[model samples]
Target: MNLELLESFGQNYPEEADGTLDCISMALTCTFNSWSRDGHKLVSASTDNIVSQWDVLSGDCDQRFRFPSPILKVQYHPRDQNKVLVCPMKSAPVMLTLSDSKHVVLP
Candidate 1:
């Protein structure tokens, strides 16, 4: 695994920096689902049981949603740009509708 350490300036710097910590233990998994209609937002999830909408251009976490169990997988809807499917390890998968109001329970 090629682990790159980011600098304080949030840029990729040399590995042999003056004071760089070599070890990190944060349990997180992330993947991009799809781009928003406005081309500004991206949907991503982590093992920490959190789903977040990120800004692709600015590289910022814009919105977050917490699940009851650790998120196992996440994917975007093919036809509708605003919908996503989230699968948790312990529970049934859920379909989240993008207007941020409706959720469909799936088996």
Candidate 2:
């Protein structure tokens, strides 16, 4: 990942940009979300417990969802573009519905 490219996304610190790249690479998750239906948005979850939705065209964060603990992994719902499944350290996996701002704990 190019640090310069990530820095363009409003990252004020080099460490943060590096962390974002690490998360994207480690997770191998979708950098582009289908939520936009236009391939103009992306999502990334970092160990810092923040899930961010980004605007691909503008290089801005569309929204950020924070959790109580460090995140272990993140997965998006296969069909629900507005939803993401996050596994937090020492906690149950949660289903976060972005559109409605609902957090559901999975058993």
Candidate 3:
């Protein structure tokens, strides 16, 4: 997979970044979910009850969150860079604060 970073983005991303995102080693296995507001990070959610954050430049997973249920989607908060909203298959949506690893279920 080639990830093309638009020139307008003004990042040092190579014109043609090759290979699947390291966040999800096997792209076919997990959902390539969300990117951070700054485009510096990636989040992947999988049926294996895992959520992972990866560094875009290094392609290294920086953090991992595990839940009891499979996650359908993971979205980064629009304004809070350290927070993410997670939607699970069989439970209420959750708000995760990366700074402190707090898990709060949304009402």
Candidate 4:
């Protein structure tokens, strides 16, 4: 796959943006979850054991949540603002609840 890193605002392309993440083995698909009002953060997952929360405004990964198995899909809850659903390829789905004070892991 061809990789190109654009500017923070995605309005222009940088000339020297060729860094790749070595942790990702295979990226099947990715989607943006619009949970925040400012639209700054996005959750992305791959066939690897990593789930990443990226900052679109800064073009950097803010936080990463790792899984025991390879992640098949990731999605944000529609009604709940602090919940994310993660599905693995071989196991049952997991619910990750993110709040201001604590992080809850549910099976």
Q: Which prediction has the highest lDDT against the true structure?
A: 3
lDDT assessment of candidate 3 = 0.86
Better of 2 and 3 by TM-score: 3
All candidates' TM-scores?
A: 0.62, 0.59, 0.70, 0.55
On lDDT, the stronger of 2 and 4 is 2
Candidate achieving the largest TM-score: 3
Prediction 2 global C-alpha lDDT: 0.71
lDDT of 1 by residue, 24-107 (tens): 787565743656666777888776778887778999986678888887777767667678888888889999886764789897
Q: How much lDDT does candidate 4 score?
A: 0.67
Candidate 1 stretches with Cα past 4 Å from truth are 1-40
lDDT, candidate 3, at 38: 93
Per-residue C-alpha lDDT of model 3 across residues 1-102, encoded as one tens digit per residue: 445643356657767858774574745478648988999988889767899988999989988998898888899999887999999988999999988888
Q: Give the range of the ten consecutive residues with the poorest summed lDDT in model 3.
A: 1-10
Candidate 3 Cα errors over 4 Å, as ranges = 1-28
How far is 92's C-alpha from truth in model 2 (Å)? 0.5
Clashes of each: 0, 0, 0, 0
Give, for candidate 1, the lowest lDDT window spanning 10 residues: 1-10
Model 2 C-alpha lDDT per residue in residues 1-107, reported as the tens digit of each score? 86776555664655544443334445534322334444666777765568887788899987788778877777667766687787778899998887878899999
